[model samples]
Target: MARKTFNAQAHSLCLLVLVIVDAAAARGDVVSANASGEAMAQREFDYFALALQWPGSYCQRTRHCCSSSACCQSNPLAEFTIHGLWPDYNDGHYPSCCRDSDFSIKKISSLMPELQKHWPSLSCGSPSLCHGGKGIRQIFLYLNRNLLRSQFPDEKKHGTCSYPVILDEYSYFSVALDLYFKYNITKILSNEGILASNAETYSVEDIISAIKKAVGALPLLECRRGNGLNGDASSAISWLIVNEPFAPFNVL
Candidate 1:
């Protein structure tokens, strides 16, 4: 099979946390196949890819953004937030919606405050759009209600595949939040003088080198042309490979 690759055109800074599978396993030497030649199940994965997005860049590109959106609020986010923590193979093919688990808001209720601050939904549109006289409090209530109804799409898609290791929804989100806080990409860049700016310009090499120096690993850099913006937006993705007999979470 042809190996797949990551090909996302991010508008703002993004981060990908890749957990590489063992060389022997990734090479498919130990993988088992059914008698008909099809792979038994799609649960197996080579690694986990945690994606982080910058609200400033995302909100800037969104045309119909409104106050309902977290980034569009009066106090906007000036930092990188969690996009997703996906389980992916070395070939780039990832397992998603592996099981019939539904995303439940109550499952991770304890983590609501942190999730709201770190992994907020950037999607826009609210009752205020259609109905007038709705205050911010009402709009927030409407949004929260919507969140309860829709649940988290990422949980049903990527989080489900993180079974046995991740265990449950709380664990899955907790792990991601922990990793995001630990890495602190926003602080890392700021420490290297790579602050978000409209007038300043930075070379791609400098950005990558700074992250690599801080994290002690080379990262994949992705950039996109901003709409009527001064410079291109860049995303830095980093990964760590883990072999068998070792827990993937411990490596980070």
Candidate 2:
């Protein structure tokens, strides 16, 4: 009878020990998950920088415009296109390719029409039937495939890392387009009599002033050596950087 009693107590103790271990393991998993969440939260960028690219300057500087880009004679666009909205550290260094997210056409479906008009792909497989040219499924599929190469990195690297930043993927791209509409540098320069022309070179300081006066804030101006015939002629193209990540972007 004593032996049987001891056996029962041992079986009960074993079951109790198993239950305690399971509870400890569950708590450990929760702790690990919380730590991971905190780490990803810390990965949020310090600031956001919107980089605008001018096709005229790009074609001039490169000396070779892609047949599909805005610089194409068949479809010249005076307005600047979005180069990227980068996540930057205050000191100027930026982070990129931080995470991976599948490129979903549905995510950008609504923006496709506008993107074709404004952010047309620079390089393409079928240049003759570029998205703006043929307007068919072939071109559509091509953009979906090539966006991963040409322009989808923003979502992967910066956008995904931007936790608690904004609404979602749609919001991210839309906000950028909204900012583009608000700051039309071409219009600002024209008002200041600093028009874009290969014939006459405009001073960089004047260009910066034109933008600042319009926006009521300072900007970061970047220049590139033109590959155009007037490469030496003050016809260099300039890029502007406007990202204040710590603060919310008030697109007005």
How high is the CA lDDT of each candidate model?
Answer: 0.54, 0.44
Per-prediction backbone clash count? 0, 4
Local distance difference test, candidate 1: 0.54
- Per residue, candidate 1 scores C-alpha lDDT tens digits across 125-214 of 332211122221232343354432112454444556666556667787788888788667778878988877655566666665676667
Candidate 2 local Cα displacement, residue 59, angstroms: 2.9
Against the hidden reference, what TM-scores do the models get?
0.69, 0.61
| Cα lDDT over the full model 2 | 0.44
Model 2: how far residue 23 lies from native, Å: 41
Per-residue lDDT value at 90 in model 1: 58
Model 2 is weakest, by summed lDDT over 10 consecutive residues, at: 14-23
How does candidate 2 fare on TM-score?
0.61
RMSD for all candidates, in order, please.
9.9, 24.2
